[model samples]
Target: MALQVGLVGLPNVGKSTLFNAVSQAGAEAANFPFCTIDPNVGVVAVPDERLTRLAELAASKKVVPTAIEFVDIAGLVAGASKGEGLGNQFLAHIREVDAICNVVRCFDDDDIVHVSGSVDPARDVEIITTELVLADLATVEKRLDRANRTARTGDKDAIRERDVIEALRDHLGDGRVARTFPGELPPAVARELSLLTAKPVLYAANVAEDDLGQGGEARGNPYVEVVRKLAEEEGAEVVVISAQVESELAELAGDERQEYLDDLGLDRSGLERLIDRAYQLLGLLTYFTAGPQEARAWTVPSGSTAPRAAREIHTDFERGFIKAEVIAYDDYDRLGSEAAARDAGRLRIEGKEYVVADGDVIHFRFNV
Candidate 1:
């Protein structure tokens, strides 16, 4: 399954605009609030120049890039936890995602309405955070109640579970997110208590065209400062992008796009940075399968075992476990071919215990 990320923010923060620009899925982007009533899902291919080069080296007939899923949920209101302005429904959509791309509007456009009536990223963050906290508090409370009932039966595990849930409830009650907890909770416990704010966050600072290379301050935007501080405290990542600029950049032809970005004094598209950050946030790594038939990239968690990585390709591959022929992308690029790399002792045969690395070119040897 593709790693899922939810785009969330107050109304008119360009959540849908950034979604359309990244996914090219033509999601509704209007000046009105709550334009995206239903969640807009788009599967975007992760861009990798290394994949293209590997495909060229292998002389493959088809090249497949790995993809990530982006979900553009409806605008979240201040009282979304209480079902205000499609709030509960949207928060449900957010709960289903693995991570969040919090779109904080750092741009100013009188034509584009701000749902909060002003641009205050700190206040916007508070509103959204509070709603998520409220939603999580309700979820944790229900779970705690159920666990409390189960605890009376003298199930020691249930008592421990109740203790954790109550602790989480207290934290959420204090306007803190579940992710702020000190240690990792069991997956079962986490699944039972759907915590909205616990998901990893990537702050997308929506800036204007002039602010492309200006470190998000050309417009003297306040959200830039607020997001920076929040990210610092949470040890999260942030990327500043001009949605309007990227929308226009997406329309240009290949060479023209580079020229346009150069004209704007930008090194690369904010959309690219956003995608890269999302990929990293998921702890995902890409491995390549190169052959004459196809050269493809596959996404796997960073520490995925060989068998687990094979399962991502096909269940049969995992079931029929065998050693894998692996070569780092850099070795292939330097040594020119698989045979040459093998002859030079750069290629390796790894077992099931081998943990896959990012940018690894793997050829699985399996018999089904």
Candidate 2:
């Protein structure tokens, strides 16, 4: 699956710093990782321990993990709806992404000047939300104009569309986002508009390193609390991160990296948490394939059937239309290998209707 999340915030929110860490991690993951889909995009491997363990069990020569793309959108400013400070370009970039990760500045520092002079999560969120809502309002109005013209022909479908568009117009006019609008729009119209505000969003509270939680409780940054509360109201997820920590972690490897995290009393870096949350935001899950040649992770939207997941590996796998060999990760860990799992009756044959599960080890039996 191609999970793409766009990072957007006003200047000086550490968006660029966060992207730099992602870029380095992507580059270090593999030779073919999509570290540079474009000037501002980086793709990193989805962190999964099962993939590594499977590789060990299979004695695989290589390991490949599913990747997610992060796009660094242009900085936003007031009047983005009217194209101020390249606002139009920024909004366009966001429209092309699957989800949005708004990096909000929560850490205060005299050296790092905030665009608004002082950090205020409420004001920062409002500015971005207003811009997106304004842009969506523009889109709804244009679409309504065309729908109204079509409705003049007395076409029932056009009339219905015009009514729907009018409703959307009013909703946006009330300073509401499309995602929060009551009920759902027709699928076709929704796709046509591709309203930016409709995309799922999460807030990354970029705090100072010292303010980040070590292992358990939060370090008590009032800024993070504000972001968390705002995210709660918006029905969005929040990931507290320190760009400074991620940046330093990106430059270390092996025991050095582990040592750094240990000293900080953290098990993983913030980028890892961000990616995991992003996956949840998009309703994604990971499954695995293991062999002597390689052990790999593949992502699929939750509730995907066996045949649908087979398509992620190759279209032919789905075309062949055969059963799948499935082994739960726990069974694999206990039995130790495919042969062992088979002998122990831990592996089962599943049909096309079988929904692929997270952490499932699958071997598709296909003819094509």
Candidate 3:
């Protein structure tokens, strides 16, 4: 499955605007609140200059880039946990995502209505975080209730589960996420109780165009400070992007786009940085399968074993396990060809235990 990220925030925070800019899928972006009724799901090809360069060097006909899935869920409200404004339904969508891109409205636009009647990003973030925490607390309470029932019957495993639930409940009660409970949670417990706040989050500060390169140091943007502080505490990643500006940049021609970015003193699009940050948050790595017929990039988690990565290609390849012939893209490029790389001892035959690295060019040998 592709790494899924949920774009969540209060209404009118430019979540759909950022979504449209990054995915190039036209999701409705209106001035009214709650315009995005249903979730907009789009698969965005992760941009890697190395993959593009490899494709060019290989002279392959088809160039396939690895992709990540972004889900633009409805804007969450203050009482979302209590069934307010598409509440539980949207929270349910969040539970399915692997990570989150919390888009906070840092820009000021009188035309765009703020759901809270004012542009206060800190308050908005608190409201959304509170909802997630409340929802998680509710889940923890239910699990604790069930575990308590089983513990009364002298189930050792259930008693342990009850203890964990109590700890989690304490944390959630203090407005902290259950993920901060300080230990490795059992997979069974994690699977049974999908904690919304447990997912990794990247704060997307939807700033004004002038503040883009300020790195959140610009004055008058209270939300940037809030997000920066949160990121510092959680060791999370934060990125600044002007969704309105990016949307306009997306509509321009190639040279015109470059000129606009250059004028803004940016070397690349904010959308690219956002996507790259999402990939890093998910710990995703890319590997290429190159040949005359087709050249494609595949995405996998960083620590994925060779066999597991093979399954990403085909189940048959994984079932019929064999060694993988691997060459680093850099080495391949320097050596010019596979034969030259092998002769120079740059290619390696790795076993199933080998963890695939990013930028590896791999050829798998398998029997059906």
Who wins the TM-score comparison? 1
**Clashing pairs for predicted structure model 1, backbone only:** none
**Model 1, CA-based lDDT:** 0.86
What is the full ranking by TM-score, best candidate first?
Answer: 1, 3, 2
* lDDT: worst 10-residue window of model 3: 213-222
Q: Give every collision pair in model 3.
A: none
lDDT, candidate 2, 164-225, per-residue tens = 88999999999998998886688999999999999999999988888876762255888888
Q: State model 3's lDDT.
A: 0.86
Report lDDT (CA) for all predictions: 0.86, 0.87, 0.86
Question: Rank order by lDDT, top first?
Answer: 2, 1, 3
Model 1, C-alpha of 78: deviation from truth (Å): 0.6
The all-Cα superposition gives candidate 2 an RMSD in Å to the true structure of 4.2
Residues 1-368, candidate 3: write the lDDT tens digits: 58889999999999999999878888898887678888899888877887777776677888888888889998999999989997998998999999988999987789888999998877887898899999999998988888889889888887887887888888899999765778556799899898999998998889888887633234566768878887888888988888977888978977999888888877777778887888898888889888776789998889999888888899998999789999999998898877789999999999999999999999999997
RMSD of 1: 1.6
